[model samples]
Target: MDGDLRGLLPDDAQTRQEPKLMHPFKNFQLNNAIFAAIWLVFLAAVLVQVYLGAGYSARDKVWMTACVAVFSAFYFWAFGSMESHPSGWSQFSRAMLRWAVLLVIALASVPVIKTGVISYAPYLAAMLGFSVPWRKSLPIVAATGVVGTLAVWFVAPEDLGWSSLVLFATPFLLVAVGVFSQYDVSRYQLQHELDLAQQRENIATDVHDLLGHSLTVINLKSEVARRALHNNAEQAEKELKEIAELSRLALAEVRATVTQMRTPTFAGEVQGARRALETKGITAHLPERLTPAGEHETVFSWCLRELTTNVVRHSGANTCWVSVNADKLQVTDDGSGFSTDTVQNREGGLAGLRERVEAAGGRLIVRREHGLTRVLITMSGDSELMRDGAVVQEASE
Candidate 1:
């Protein structure tokens, strides 16, 4: 029942708090004019078919004209209100009721006038396609086609040929085409929404990883400085300076993370990782630079940042090593090695990192071997890393 009520409202009503004029017609103030023109054309067509095509008594003509007028009015009302209604049961019910009234009137009047009012089938089918679920509309449309064809066959057996078949089939064909176009539009909209959602998730994950690790380090240094202040003056001064430096770095990182447009390069990340590890009293073994022959710098930089963060936050190791090559990058820590269960339960960051790696046509692997917790990322030669690298190099040269 709730669903039915929701379906009676416009599509935008639930999403938009205030009404805004939409494209094509609303922006130009031409919607009413266009609808009026279309209705005029429809009315003219129906009058021509009734007055000229069908031979009837004056009384019957008047009745048929009244019926046509009523049918046209009902059709116009339904079409104009289509965008106001949500695409579900309420819209379908409204369309079906309109179709039912027209079908009954046309069928009943056929015996009196000796004329089958088959011309309106296309317009009725269009209404069904536009309003109802395609699956329901399709079967209904097929049934209409069969009944209309049979009616024509019985009415004039001598004229039971290709013309009758064409008349019956055209409406169904048109309805199918119209419905599929709507389906394509719906698919495009869904894809756009998914893309926007993915972008938001990526931004959130990046921000969390950036702030969480930096803040943890800053807190640890501040605590160390507090303890040293009571025992040793020189050591406390050194710790205090490091705390200030770490705070400044964190502030810069926060700014960069929020901007989202600039990504740290592999070299920059390696340097940053060394400083972070040193502050935590952990040994850092990192390469000076990584020159992989691909465009994958941003993804690699992100992976490096995430791995370094995990090492600082979770690993109790005294030493951390980062190795980068043409095809792969690995971060190893001789920390308290993590079990698969621990990683699954505690490592939400790795899941986001894994998605980023896979999107770049690379794979990320995490394992504990030889008492070392290792996070290895492998990239294919034809991956996004290479493509991005080439684009950057081209732009520079």
Candidate 2:
């Protein structure tokens, strides 16, 4: 059980400390599989045209038939490789290799232009649409257009003129537009993934906060109860009762925190935080309601939990106040004050809170002065601000 718990903990604290890595290929399986299948179908059609009497010479049929088989195999292999690793660059390189090979075959048609392989232009265009990324795909498509035009222009000048270039290049133009559209789709998909990741991080932090403070209070109280047990059984019994009630509240908070990210509103989170703080014997004052909390309720909830947890654990305060206004939510505590400089030197708790606060285009302020330690968190309207930057500010005087 201990081993399992340790394994479940974030890797080294350092690795978990860093930002998550993004996938290079974006949608991976869906996109790759769809494109690969399209390429395979197109190759099959090419094969039919070659062998099923599309007016090809015997040699022309053989080369086109060979190209079709090779293209299909390459599509399957590249798609599988990409599926294996969507994040790393290795699979992308493999996909590129297939594109290069197919391009070479299409370019080779120029030298053997008399072979009547020009009908397979659609297959090459399909590869462009399905395989290459926009930056590379665009240039390659243009090159293919140039080479294909030159192939027909020079190979059989009488039968195929410069005008034939446009006819041969029609498939590639269509494929180019399709590839661009897919790129837009991919961008939107990436944004959605990022939003989901942010939500997960918020949820994980909530779990950590909910359980962490409850356990700390329970431990402290249990110790107090244990010491009292030998001397005063009545006080010991009282403490144990408090522990039981606190445990139940903690369990409820855990459930609430898990569901909080999905169904966050200002009221629910504020109420949960108030209950959590009250159960821990920390006085909490919150707004009746906050206006225009927007879709950023999850972020604000996370900030509230982290600040409150810090108060219970580090601030040593008997009282805490939570205030919500136009764009800022603040937490203030009065306790045995520590040096503002000292708080900056520590990790794990306050720093993480600061990160979470600042990630949402909000700011975090930690100050110790005149027997009070205050943590003020401010969030602007933009959620993207939180995803990019999370700063650690110097504790105040």
Candidate 3:
């Protein structure tokens, strides 16, 4: 492939992070046996034509065979260059040069092969379609058809009818094959790109939520521990121990998040949020006991964890409320209220949470009602969002 065609193809670096199971290319190369078979079928037809053509001496046949053998070598070399490679400019240059040699062989053999050599047009046009920009290739392939059609008329007028029509149509059809191949390869490139980007985003959101929640509690405990250190040794030691424990859990959770093996549960967040709020001298209204929450437990868990962090960090009120069920999770704080626009544009945890919620096919709605900063997450019950277990049914009250 040359520079223009290489732009449409995937590079080694682009595919490195892609999942093997997801990509369509078999071993990341064109199917070698199938391409080899296609070439052999065409070569056999030409060789049969040469063997049967009148007035050709045995020595002339020998020379024609050598030309074909050499052409085959160059053709395969050009194609094999595309096989799973760290393809650089030098490799692309070599592929293009091999194509030029193939074209030269086709033209030079016209005296012996006659119009039979025009059979090379389809292969040459396909190579052009795959190796150059489509705009540059369209006219080049058209010219090959014109030349081949004329060769059919002038070089062997005895065989001009259906052969000319077939010759013209074959090249365009092969070029169409090349165009479709490019579409498939481009789709693989974009799919890899999207998967890689999502991986990065997931790592970012997990880390931000983990550290933000963990550190906020640690900060509050540190301050509490400091105030009591001189007057009350036991209380200070307890806070210090809790800080040490939080650090360990945070470290473990970070590892799991990176590995994508861990998911937060509603119960875990309830405990964590309660600790964070209480440490900040804010009363927390939280659920009792962890239950087998429905399909989107991770999303619900994340919502609770993230919303509680916002209450502790931003809200200046005394009481905070969090409630959850299958369809929705709501968190409200009677603190310094915020504008709806602020939630939309807030940096850090909430912004990351909003992204996670939307990606899960759920919505995050934030507003203020009756001096309470209210956040409502309405979950989507789509089967795809179900992470682990069956959906739980809640009885109507």
The candidate maximizing lDDT is 3
What's the CA error at residue 165 for candidate 1, in Å? 3.5
Who is ahead in TM-score, 2 or 3? 3
lDDT string, candidate 2, 1-397, tens digits: 6455656677786455343244333333433444556645644544665567645678876776666566566555455445344343553475566667766665554333343555555555555565556666556666766665676667567756533554446665757776876776566456556755787898898889979999999999999999999999999999999999999999998887777557555555665666566555565656653344556666776777666766667667766766665566666677665566755775545677666666767766666545666666666643221210012221343
> What TM-scores do the predictions have?
0.49, 0.43, 0.54
**lDDT (C-alpha, whole model) for all candidates:** 0.67, 0.61, 0.70
Tell me the tens digit of each residue's lDDT in model 3 across 1-397: 3446656667874555444434323222223323643654567777776789788889778878888887776566456444433333444354456557789987877778777777777777767667655666678778777777776887678888766656678778777777787776566556545645777798999999999999999999999999999999999999999999999999999998887634665665776787677656576666653544588887888788778887888778677777667777777777887677766876545778889989998888776645566677877543222211111111211
As for candidate 2, its clashing pairs are 359-386, 360-386
User: Candidate 2: where are CA atoms >4 Å away?
Assistant: 1-89, 104-116, 156-175, 178-181, 184-192, 208-232, 255-397
Query: lDDT value for candidate 3?
Result: 0.70
Ranking by lDDT: 3, 1, 2
RMSD vs true structure, all candidates: 22.0, 22.2, 21.9
Candidate 2 TM-score, true structure as reference = 0.43
